[model samples]
Target: MNSFEHDVAVQATNDDAQTTKVNAVERGYYEDPFVRYFARKGSRKSPLINRGTWVRVQAVYDSVDRFLEIYRESSCRQIVSLGSGFDSLYFQLQKKSLFREGDRFLDVDYDSVISKKVEIIRTNHELRTALRADLTQLTNTCGARTDQYVLAGVDLRVVEDLKRVAEKVAGFSLEAPTLVICELVLIYMEPKHSDAVLNYLSSSFTELLLFNFEQVGPEDPFGKQMTKNIEARGSPLMGLSAYPSAQSQKERFQKLNFNKVAAISMLEYYSKCAESLQDNVKLRIRVFLVLELIRMVKLVQEMLIQLFPMVAQVCKRI
Candidate 1:
């Protein structure tokens, strides 16, 4: 089966394009030149979808920021992004001065994705300078790695492959305080595969923080249609049925022996975090516009609520 990961990247790029056009930088959404290079021209997303993406990006950024705040005194800090796709969070964080010295960012994905990303990085001076990578040192299979950044390829289903990629390509340390991001990636995998990846992380990393962002609520009308639609497209949400709600997602981590786990739906996040941002007046206005758009398209709103209901969680391993 063809990996549907590229589709997700395209959607994100489209969202970034829309968010950039609307000047929503405060929401932590960025228009990556690499993404723009691959994005289809004239592609646009609905305002509500764009706002939801904005909220999602903000939630992830805030989680990472909180992690940094807690580990500011620590000598080693790292971020490992699974299936990083075309997202440029690492570069953006560096640009915003959030990433400090002695901090490492690693991005792992399928070989094809990593190859294209490396090509873009090699061609773009900004990305090359930010990563401090020597283009002469990179290959299609093994990505460029510098003091602060590492990009490598991995097949998440294989434990040995993950280990090799981490140890050989990325030189990741288990002792470092690491934040593992699995945004919108796990749902595409089989339950056993995703569970294996989670179990490996849980066992290997001593001080680990996991941030998972994905769709939930599979029993709802929207979820049913969403699953059907995606399956019809030949890309099923293989793990959704196993962890279909916020509580279930939280319990999954607790069962894996995480020290602490907290999960909340996107609606709750929007109410508490997104709407309460005092500094971003423009973001607040965009939230209102999304609500109004929701009212105008009730059916679309229902599908959006049901099919796109995202659960974000922060899990800690002590």
Candidate 2:
């Protein structure tokens, strides 16, 4: 496929993710009040899909929560969401009054995606009131700045574009204490582009916590099939083979001068992080399905995880 068509497919992954999130919520996996507004109504998904979505949401959410609580005392902190699709975490967190005055939440994505989101905010009462975003100055390219929120239609491959947006948006800065979230974002780009982006963030931030979620493990039978499936769908995992393991992903951040870095898989995260009876009870069905999938597929020659939940890490920049 051509670049434009490939980009459209890449953008559709946002819908795929949102659909999964909506299904997860409908299935009682988590509480996300704003996802419904963006996700189109869809039929309930399998226990496996719901649980997989829950793992992604829970891991990233936990990392963001930890960062906010740890730096709650700091002033004018920022949360920057790269390739932020229809995610509503900022609005949800804002409802709970988690962000103090001067703190900003910025969501950056492609122009087409951001345009639709901007229109949704303009038309939706809850969204407009929650963010208090004034869209009077909305442009063709899709960008709006408010006291506590920023929506920018950006091409993330260009570091200068991000720098420009950061320069323009309050609390979004290279030197500021920033939590950079990139969920399923990096795998779309070439390694050189993504590496440059990471290096820029690493070198510039006075304090940074990067939460990167993407595909990993492409050497095994399951991984090989997973890679083929993704590529056949038109949007290939361009950067997957380069950083195909958790250790490789961890080292990618550590080499960027991060002081603290750790990467964990979905299976490992479930084993270590799920503490309560409720969580276990809720997830038991999905766990059974996961093992069943292993048995059924012969786990591509062995019972193993194909795609990852993501590298849940504290990737703190020194």
Query: Which structure among the candidates has the greatest lDDT?
Result: 2
Show pairs that collide, candidate 1: none
Off by over 4 Å in 1: 1-38, 132-141, 278-284, 287-318
Q: Candidate 2, overall lDDT?
A: 0.76
TM-score, each model?
0.82, 0.87
Top of the candidates by TM-score? 2
Clashing pairs in 2: none
Q: Report the C-alpha lDDT of model 1 over 57-158, residue by residue, as the tens digit.
A: 677777789888989998888888887876677877877788887888888877777777778877777677765547444444567666778888787888
Where is model 2 more than 4 Å wrong at Cα? Answer: 136-141, 277-318
Candidate 2: tens digits of C-alpha lDDT, residues 21-73: 98878767788888988989788676556666777788888878888898888
Clashes of each: 0, 0
